[model samples]
Target: MLTIIDKYILKKYLTTFGVMLGLFAPIGIVIDVSEKINKMIENKIPVVDILIYYYHFTIYFTNLLFPIFLFLSVIWFTSKLANDTEIIAILSSGISFTRFLRPFIIGASIVSIIILLMGFFIVPKSSEGFNNFRYTYLRGDGKQAMRGESTDVFRQISNDEFIYVNSFDVASKTAYNFTYEKFTKDKLAYKISASRIQWNPKTKRYTLYDYVKRTVGGLDDKIEKLDKKEAKFNFDLEDLTPVVYIAETLSLVKLNRFIEKEKKRGSSNVNVYLVVLYKKYSIPVSAFILTIIAVSVSSMKRRGGMGLSLAIGIAVAFSFVFFDKIFGTLAEKSSFPPLLAVWFPNIIFGILAIILLRNAKE
Candidate 1:
């Protein structure tokens, strides 16, 4: 059902994209290794682990910069076609420009689907490993990467229940100075305090040390004490000591459930997670928008040839990344809506795509 021209253009689009990615990915890996090699040596990290870390980082970096590579590749190859007068020949062959764009749209659709799958499935796993290694070994400051992984935790578990811990060790799944309180109608109902609390993976329960409980009555409170107690609580250790990269490691379904749970917990850090969620969808859709814009901008031949097109494409790509970072930072630091921040660059670039396409058509 497809014509020869359609097949040819489609092949060119995908082939150029593939070549661009293949060429640049190694450069990225080399630079990353060069930067981290000293740290790996200092830490005496194994050669196999270093190689594995770079493997995860390669996927992470490629997916992170997919839109830029996609835009530049489209512009690069299309500009070449224009300089060779191939576009003019195709147009003169009784083919409308709109029909000529069919292959491009098809190519964008294919790439977008792959990007979407990478975001939802592959990237999360790669990011977890990549970030974990980078934070643990390559960087001396693990707290910045993992956030509250080894800090005190305090949260309102429910309207009537509150919990606190003086300090927690994620590696050991243990907490010190643990406290839980229940209240009714602005009055304390019961309170429990313990010197230590530890998660027992084998039993799937918490063991508390030097446990104490207080039950309040009208004018008196009954106090109970124990050396140790095994119990279960309504929250998980992950909920207590949240890592900054926690959201980056979840699939779409798990991400949605985590977001809903965080909302119920009244967490102030929900916007950070929301930004992650919205960007996963936004980044893939922007690939289609950027492809349209890239094709439009480079389809016409200029005296400057491919250089001019590549310069313009790279400039536009950098601006897209800049705007995304600014808005994303605003969402994380200020009261800006995460959904709006994530999609604003896409909305603006999509409009640019339309205007450029119209001008190219004219």
Candidate 2:
């Protein structure tokens, strides 16, 4: 149960967090606005629209960094108490350090929950609209979004098939320098080469131009020339496009569906998508872990006041970001489990929080 003092501290912590995020976010965007000023002007983004742009930016900007601030907020609030001799006074009143933590935990827990919601559910959805708005309106003439529908560097329609192309133009929905391979019975059965492959949207089939087909069996070889008007190949946008964060843009259900489709097709390099899926859920729980870390580090009164706490909070937060990237790189390039890569940083920090909480109380 939280006593009156506990409630007071909790309120203070939350208040500080809100104020800091509230102020810092706009300042950050203002900085962004300045950086993009030339492009914004060139794109003719109106002043009013600029405000709307900032509004959208804040949703993602704040969400992107809320966990960091929440952790720092804990440190700031706790350290303020310590630096003010309030912590000593509370301890002197026979309130054990452990007992005093109840309120901080409670406060941090609430913050964590809020942050988690923003990270998984709210932020991803908002980011798409925000990014689209910027690229369409604020990015100006030098930039053009990937408008073409055709894609390359993907698993082909046939099982054990693969294709790689330098670029695909959306205007014609065609790919160039296309090579398609087919493997059967664990043997390379055939190879197809086309200078260009196009999508006839009206027909819902692909057409390859100036193509050659070759087949090899044991010592037998055959070659055929293609002068056909169109060649039919079934591939969806999701199948051929270089899997970027497109999977991430989808909701949990949609993301899972994509994962299943890609798996059934025997596409490797689905690790990035899997990472995004797990992170959607895992990131929310981190709100809890980060809160614990913050309260443990910051909720004490020290001579340096909130500044010291803030620094420590930032250090821990950055460590999480750094390790997550490092592990992600390892997962993509090396043979590490994608799930483990995304979650390892969180796990490490969570353990540290537990240890810190124990040490803080003692």
Candidate 3:
């Protein structure tokens, strides 16, 4: 069912895209290494760890800049075709412009599939490794940053139970001025207070210092006190204090579950997680939109030649990234809708692609 021209253009499309990634990935690695080498040396990082970090870094880099690389590749190859009059020759052979675009759409579909799979599965794992390595060795106070806010932590662990801690220490897995309360039908049921609480990972239990429990009843209150007590809670340590980048480290399924759990907990940063979730889909859809835009922009010979096309392509790509970041930040900081913020760039550029394609066809 495939024509000779379709195969030829598809091969060119895929090969050029691959070559673009091949060329830029090493440059990205080199730049990253140059920036982080001193920190690695200071930390006395192992060679194996550094190698592993770069492996993850490659995936992270490719996924982050996929659109730019894809756009440039399409423009580069299509401009070459235009300069050589190859596209003009093909079109003169009684092929309609819309028919000529079949291969490009197919290529875009292929790239979109790859992007979707990577965003859903591969990039999450690589992001975890890349971000963990950076925070563990590259940044000052990274541990505290990863642990998120350590003071005045409060969370609803369940519909009826809530917990609070004045301060937490990441290194010791300890909380100070810990309080736990339970409510039944909006009425006070019981309360537990501890001067300090330390998690014993080996035992999967908590050791509470100066532990006290008070029970509420009809016209009566009973209180119990203890010097120290070992207990188990329904929540994990991560549930108590999650990392700032925890959402980025989870795969699609886990991220969905995490969002649901956070929604139940009434987390204020739910918008941030929603933005991440929506972006995983929006970015892949941009592959199609950007590919179309690139082809439309560069499919004709110009007085300025490939340079003009490339300049336009780069400007458009940067504008797309700029719009994505602006909306993402707005959603994260304000109450903007995450779904709208993620898709707005794609929607704007999609319309631009349509206009450009129509002009190119004419």
Candidate 4:
């Protein structure tokens, strides 16, 4: 069912895309190493760890810029075809422009599937490793940074239990002015307060200083006080000290579950998580849009040659990234809808692709 032309174009498409990735990957690694080398030396980071970190970084970097890479590769190869008069000959052979696009669509489908699979399973693991490495070895205040804000933390640990802390120390795993409240049928059943609470990892327990417990009754209140108390709670320090990039570190299934949990907990950063979740699908869908745009723009022979086409392709690619970043920031920082932010760039570029294709056909 496949023609020689289709096979030829598909081979060029895949090989060019792979070559583009190969070319950019080393550049990215070199830039990253240059920035992080001093930190690595200062921390005496293991060479094995550094190598592993870059391995994950490559996946994270590639996935982040996959559309741009695909777009450029398509433009590069198609422009070559146009320059060599291959496209003109193919069009002259009575193959409709739409028919000529079949292999391109097929190539896009293959890339999209690979990107989708990576987004679902592979990229999450790589993201976790990449971020963890940066925070653990590269940042001076890594734990505090990873844990986000250090003060005024609140969380609902369960349906009936809520916890609050005025401030937390990531280095010591300590919470100051800690309060734990339990409600039964929306009425306060009991409350625990501590001047200071520290997590003892060795014991897997909490030591609360100046601890007090209050019990509510129909007619009176019972209060117990202690200089120090050691006990277990339903939640751990991780519950209070959520990493800023926690959502990015989860696989698709886990990310969905995390979003639901964050929603129940009334997390303020839920929009950031939603943006990440929406982009997993949006980025893959961009493969098709960018492929079509690339073909449309470069399939026609122009006096400007491949260099001109590449310049245009780079501009368009950067513009796409710019739009994506702007909308993503708006969604993360403001009340803009995350789903719309994720798809708006694709929608705009999809329209452009259609218009360009029509012009090329004409």
Q: Which one wins on lDDT?
A: 4
Taking the tens digit of each residue's C-alpha lDDT, what string does model 4 give over 60-132?
A: 9999989789999999999999999999999999999999999999999999999999999999889878876
Candidate 2 local Cα displacement, residue 88, angstroms: 2.6
Q: In candidate 1, how many Å is residue 129 off?
A: 1.3
lDDT of 3 at 33: 92
Task: Give Cα-based local distance difference scores for all models.
Answer: 0.85, 0.72, 0.87, 0.88
Better candidate by TM-score, 1 or 3: 1
Which residue pairs of candidate 1 clash? Answer: none
Error of 1 at 351 (Å): 0.8
Per-residue lDDT of model 3, residues 1-362, tens digit only: 77999999999999999999999999999999999888677767789988999999999999988989999999999999999999999999999999999999999999999989998999988987887677556666444433324457788888899899865654467777899999999988999999888899999999999999999989899999999999998776655444456677789998999889889888888998999899999998998899989999999999999999999999999899999999999999999999999999999999999999999899
Candidate 4 or 1, higher TM-score: 1
Candidate 2 residues lying further than 4 Å off, grouped into runs, are 45-53, 133-242
Model 2: ten consecutive residues of lowest lDDT = 142-151
Which scores greater on lDDT, model 2 or model 3?
3
Best by the TM-score measure = 1
Q: Return the lDDT, model 1, position 194.
A: 98
